[model samples]
Target: MTASYPHTRLRRTRATAWSRALHRETTLTPADLIWPLFVTEGVQVEQPVAALPGVSRWSVDLIVDRAREAVELGIPVLALFPNTQPDRRSEDGAEARNPDNLMCRAIRAVRDALGDRIGLLTDVALDPYTSHGQDGLIDDAGYVLNDETVEALVGQSLNQAAAGADIIAPSDMMDGRIGAIRAALENTGHSNVQIMSYAAKYASAFYGPFRDAVGSRGLLKGDKKTYQMDPGNTEEALREVAMDLAEGADSVMVKPGLPYLDIVRRVKETFAVPVFAYQVSGEYAMIEHAVAAGAADRDAMVLETLLAFKRAGCSGVLTYHAAHAARLLHG
Candidate 1:
């Protein structure tokens, strides 16, 4: 239809790819991607996670190869998760502090191979090392003990840093652990090690695949509702972010990305820090299965979901799709 002098046309910019690119508000690239890799004990293994297609539990030697690939791809960071052997899982999660544990070994292997070309982010939680599959040690009542857990986390953080981890990420969601870990890091002369707190982590149902990836699903004795935030609240997430920031978090994360992009936006808006999001295991699995079911184009869906995080004000995202997205972006 013909328009009058005062009429406006919104589709002009959307008419062409070049026009759309020039008018775009958010851009996704490999630099904004942080690949999350799972490490299991071995030399040349790539254990497929059946629940999480295209994801695997790589061994130490192969992890070095992953680090080299990340360096080549311009992906600035790689978050490492460990699948502890059955015999190594303990009640106190004491293996978490071992200098030569699976996680520590993976961190060292990567750091030694790639140097500082890519940041090695180690998850500072005990779920992978615990017999009960809880992030913290539980008492007779099966309730997670806060103070004790903080101590264990502090030890875990120090151990990771000692193993040359560039960032110590506390994903446990326990109270007072950030400050304690920071203080411990400084006291141990590892003051430059960054702390990326999983500040607004919600106890959401989207973590099943993650638990499976880390081999913790079956061992989980109870849920983490007492520690991780409830999914029904928003104000509480801000409070959690604020507390973590004030406690000396170098940066903060909002987990289970798509479901909590609101929290990511609010965190970036309010704190004005380098807020990050985790395009977690379940999210990855859903997209993979959707592509398998022919619901959406795989490449398009991956980039769209990642760009949503950038539009919501995230500095970067920890995603399993980092490699695929990087290759697409490069192409």
Candidate 2:
């Protein structure tokens, strides 16, 4: 007799845990995470960011201890951001070139304490150092100038490189900055330093908590619509990725990860490069809020969200929950 309606059982494979596991397409592990940490000036202090629940701005001393914990958890890298003090903020952002600046100091301390046991990535941008909270230098007309900002970025990149930054991450989104930075690194003999370009950074509402963490929320006079990519565009992202790759980016990143998994997938498939994503501040806060409201299981939500990145073809993720998630994975 011919097969009937009940002949095919599609759910048979899912009937057993081993079968389900074998068919799983995505997985999360400790190696697929890069912890993003916030730094402030002081000793032994951990200031909690109000908007980003469970996240803190640590001092260099406390960060060293945190680095040790991350190493123990098998997380391969850590990205650093600084909460630059008001007095240090300037129109020219000259403090960014200071070798003893807070970010550089933290980089040096972590490298000295851990060496090659963990990779240290540093943020190279003027937003934290500028009084106006813009990523680049502003002209008299209040417009951000591309070439001027590239000059400052070169100085900032070399400064971080001198402090032992293993990866120089330029999140500014300024045109031609990647090529300029690559040339500067080669000339400065930091040829081994990797460049993880924020190749498709979007100007989304998802950055509120991150601004608060860096103390730039109230300082930004206007939106960053000119430089950052519009959230409505997709083809522009591929063009940006192509430019960065042509300029010699070691890897590329997609920001605000989950909402743009399509972009992540497209970039990875088109370029066949090491693609990464940033589970940005607002995304982190939203998940935490849902968990707090009893709408979601915290541990399950974290693991599920992280696994989604892998399924979307992200080589790794820069996430606020890296440490806690790493602990869960290790357990």
Cα RMSD (Å) per model? Answer: 0.9, 1.6
If scored against the real structure, what TM-score would every candidate get? 0.98, 0.97
Provide the clashing-pair count of each candidate structure: 0, 0
Residue 176 in candidate 2, Cα distance off native in Å: 0.5
Best by TM-score: 1
The segments of candidate 2 whose C-alpha lies over 4 angstroms from its true place after superposition are 1-8
Query: Each model's C-alpha lDDT?
Result: 0.93, 0.94
- How far out, in Å, is residue 98 in model 1? 0.4
What TM-score does prediction 1 earn? 0.98
Q: Model 2, poorest ten-residue lDDT window?
A: 1-10
